[model samples]
Target: MVDELQDSVPLLVFLGVLSASYVDHVALRRHRRQILHLQVLEYYTRPGDLILFNGRAKVSALQRSLTRAEWDHVAIVVPSRDGGHLQLLEVTGDGVTLSPLTSRLLAYSTFHVRYFALRKLRTPLLSRAVVNDLLERFTAEVEGLSYGLSLRRLLHARQTEPALSRDSTFFCSELVAHAYKALGLISSSSEANDFWPGSFSPGDFVDAELGRHGASLSPEIIIDCKLLEVATATKRSPST
Candidate 1:
């Protein structure tokens, strides 16, 4: 019996070590996946790319409820010259403006943003120079434009109808549509209000919404960034 017990001791220790090794391997792989997912935005974004948001604010909730869409906001990516960071062209309540990607991400905790790339064929439509020129001209022309927000407009959007005419003010999705139009990606006859935030999302629903305006803007999503909490934790981590 003593000899049998001594033989079992080595087997038990080996089994325990083997189980621990497997657990550690699994944890390391999980950690790697989290890091890769977080770095996706840096790896995949390009000029004219898009970032769509599912927001948690009351206004955002209202927009999503009315549109029956998951995303309630969108921004166009503008790559920096130094290739060190990215900027976003968007229309806020403050009107048309440029904001840093990191700052925007840090500011909005209750939003999940996804990266979308323009179709390869459509990417050739606007050169970098043209994109810059159009943004500059558009920004200057609509410097102090108000964000299109009112009960009337909200009701109109619920109907999914385009505004009768383009106005001096612009809304979030409207601004993106205008940019697409100027880039020759969408029809010239299309008005800005023809687009709502949901129009950019991928689905038969978005296809029908944009089709109603006689234009199309489809971008493929590269990353959903659902691991936003992982990013937040990294931010909270002490610097090395």
Candidate 2:
């Protein structure tokens, strides 16, 4: 059964993030709500329709809302970061079911933008064959260490060395290409020199299309991954 199911059409899952540093916690929460609402209104309706969320709490709420609206397939997007050992959870009208985590780990691991891109690119290779190949190659590349150890070492090296980082980015892009290829989607990892043109600064504002799968899929949405941090200090009265 598992082998037969593995031959099905590949699911293309793209993960991206809006940085918490660029948007405050309050604003980020609100933005998430608005985005989910828009998605529900735009694409999901009736039973068996899927609405995916990275967070479990959000998934629960979505499940209730969708059930109230008569939707069935309330799929939650839980990227398994801890290798392939841990099972991912999926909730629906029939209650929660456990499945092998296939999505990229970045979905829940961190709020970093680059991690999001890398993870998204890695999702299409979740099949047993591709995953086994990736595991073997990754192991071969970083011999002697446990899988977790090797992954940590790779991540650290990518962070500490500029050349390694660049190579890692290229590797991530290649993975994304492979994912798209598996799913039969056209993909281009074009680099942008400047997110905004002219004298525009950080908060100036602009809209960019991140990527798109096809005519049937909704356009990939990209918004500024910025967050603002504020600090306040209390004043002390002068001594008499």
Candidate 3:
């Protein structure tokens, strides 16, 4: 049975790639009208915002298939503290790192970005300074840890009760979830490893088959994940 399942793995992955391609097509078509220029996005976006990436690569397709969601990766916006430049705090293969937002978007021509804003939330409890301090401390603590992609741990996630990750390693969504939890935006009981890239998505997009434990945000904080196409060539106009 193990041999048979092993032999079928390739076929399953191939089918996943095909399915993800179709979904990408439909999603891009539906949100084509809502695309925004990269510069315009950078100017308006601030810290504590979330960014989702949808890539056309086979690995990305497999991720989409595994999670049964549109987003394959997630990142949090962070203050650059360098003349007000925009940067993203993300967990890549190189581990937890900061990268210029515009350059990262420009790196992948086939990948499109979706923005999630929290600026609309007006609550006295939502302190930007506190969140920023937490972000700084969190990033400083886990800056160069290895990206966690252990198949064993992933399989363990299938169990009735998924294990909480308190290790140094972090995948993209796990890192974001941890940050959210540290900022008091999510419940302390929320397991970072239980969150996939799709878990942070707006509305009912979370996949039940993945065994994700659904870490919801605080009721006071509203996430505006409007699918805006980030244009590579488009520049911000002179006037606001």
Candidate 4:
């Protein structure tokens, strides 16, 4: 009986080690799978993709907002903008960069103001006094009223029925137009009117064109935008 018990002890020890080894292997695989999942998701980002986010939220807030699927695919970078903020960076499989916001505050303000105003005053009834006041304010805020007017027209096009037009080509073309206007590359509003179409499709790959062109680049980049969603559930408490 003693010899039998001694023989069984070695077998138990060997079984214990095998179980531990198996658990470790499983855990390692799960970890690796998660890492690979992230890689696969971020594989779709492209260069010059306009990344946008409010520069006032916590980095974690941004992270939580993202789907696990998007989170896995893109790289995340916190931008050191004036306010406490973080920016997401997505690296494409082909090594491109993209972001949500492509223009500065002045450009955005012009676009938004014109867009909102047009929506507010779509009818043919034009109150000259009101129109003059709006134009004055717009002129004071924006350097180029003509460009703002042109961009406003584009915004109108975007707002029209079958919104976004038949083709998404307008989206990229308008973006490039705004960027050039913001940079002062084109002198007159008419010159800026010339559209340069770009192929920017979601899930499409983009390379870091800005970097190649010697544009200022951010060091850290992330794959997806994270936004927060709160969920509430009612449940009965367990009785003691």
Candidate 5:
């Protein structure tokens, strides 16, 4: 019996370790899966909403340090008409293009993400159809444009320039700025006359100006798998 107990101790220890490891992996994968599921769901994010990222890059680090912003990059949410999936219109080193929202979120899930924010524009001002129309116009206009490569130009863009139209190349913020500008959301009336991409950073979405009053924008918290909140809400919804 003594010999049998001694042999069983090693087996028990191994099983305990294996069980603990399985639990840990399950919890971690659960979180990753939740984020993925929510990010891919349709109507989880509306069109024209902006998902901002506090990325890890040399330029992003420099911009964050200099501008006192938690985020350095931004992408525009584009909800599909079929209500099946979503896409993002973004300008990265790969240039301006449309990417699936699920893939984009999955790519970032593994990063040591510093911060994320979802800024949803107030309704009525820019309805769903209006936002879609503006995006279509932009897609047509910037067909062959490359990503903005000139830091000097990006850092120095001024809305006060004689020409109000943005340059051919675009940065992430530039694409967002142009979309809102085309919708007349950030016009002189809103005190957002600075539609220049260089003049705005990803953090500027926090307090967007609308006409005479400054709209206090609150973003959806995007860490700790909180993105699943969208999915949870959907599952509990009577509409769904």
Candidate 6:
């Protein structure tokens, strides 16, 4: 059975891609609730939260299909350093950027914006000093880092739960994994974390399997996955 399933992986991936490609054609078909549900979410979420995104773009839809995951993108919530509001740190095609979460909602018209998981730690994996250290390191060195361009590496990876890598270059999941390893959130050896990047995709973080009682990672790391909207389906925009 295992062998048969392995052989079917390719067929499954193809079906996923084929299914996701139609998103753009029926983008307007999505039904949205009339009342905007923003104030509560904004008031509830604070800095250091993680957001798993189901982008409204054809590329995002394609990835969602490919990974068979509800979310295709992940970003870290960052409090504005200069004050006033919150922002997100993520590597899009434009590379790692700091932007307001509120602006993100306003920028898009698609209903996909409503589909995001506002994840946070049940208990902080690291101290404030450690968290600051990691943030500082990324800030100092994240410049010129580019979004990883290939899904092939993730697809062809060894059948390991937490895939590993050692490259300085960045992909969205790799970047988040790096943070997980650095803050001692993952149980593998620090050495192992270095090579653990490409093995796991974003879905692995939120997968049902990983939340088993004795699983290495914590379940509370994911706080809430609310599907709210910046705008209703009446307007369609796009994702990464």
lDDT of each: 0.55, 0.26, 0.56, 0.26, 0.53, 0.48
Question: Residue 26 in model 3: shift from native, Å?
Answer: 5.3
lDDT of 5 by residue, 1-240 (tens): 532432242453454311112212332333221121233333345566677676656777777665565566777776554545677787877677777776666566556445455555554555567767776776666545677646554464554323333456666776776666666666634323233332333345424444323232333434333444444574445765
Any runs in candidate 4 off by more than 4 Å, and if so which? 1-49, 52-172, 184-213, 216-227, 230-240
Which residue segments of model 1 deviate by more than 4 Å?
A: 1-40, 79-84, 110-122, 136-144, 157-167, 204-240
When 2 and 6 are scored with TM-score, the better candidate is 6
Better of 1 and 6 by TM-score: 1
* Full ranking by lDDT: 3, 1, 5, 6, 2, 4
Rate residue 62 of model 2 by lDDT.
50
- Model 5: lDDT to the true structure: 0.53
| Tens digit per residue, CA lDDT, model 4, 77-100 | 212233222223332222222333
lDDT string for model 6 (67-126, tens) is 665566776665565655776677778876777776674453245553544554332334
Candidate 5 runs further than 4 Å off: 1-41, 80-84, 153-167, 188-208, 211-216, 223-240
User: How many steric clashes between backbone atoms does each model show?
Assistant: 0, 7, 0, 28, 0, 12
Deviation in Å, model 3, residue 123 alpha carbon? 5.8
Tens digits of per-residue lDDT for model 3 on 1-240? Answer: 542442242443454311112122344544421223344446445566676777666777777887787778878877765536777889888888888876665554334443322211111465657656777777676667678777665444542323434456788987887777666666666567778877765553222211233233321121222223432347878996
* lDDT per residue as tens, model 1, 41-113: 5433455556666665687778789878767787776655454577777888787777776566545543433
Range of the 10 consecutive residues with the lowest summed lDDT in candidate 1: 17-26
Every candidate's CA RMSD: 14.9, 18.1, 14.7, 22.6, 16.1, 13.7
Best-to-worst TM-score order: 3, 5, 1, 6, 2, 4
Candidate no. 6 TM-score? 0.56
- How many residue pairs clash in model 4? 28
Candidate 4 whole-model C-alpha lDDT, 0 to 1: 0.26
Candidate 1 clash pair list: none
lDDT of 3 at 27: 49
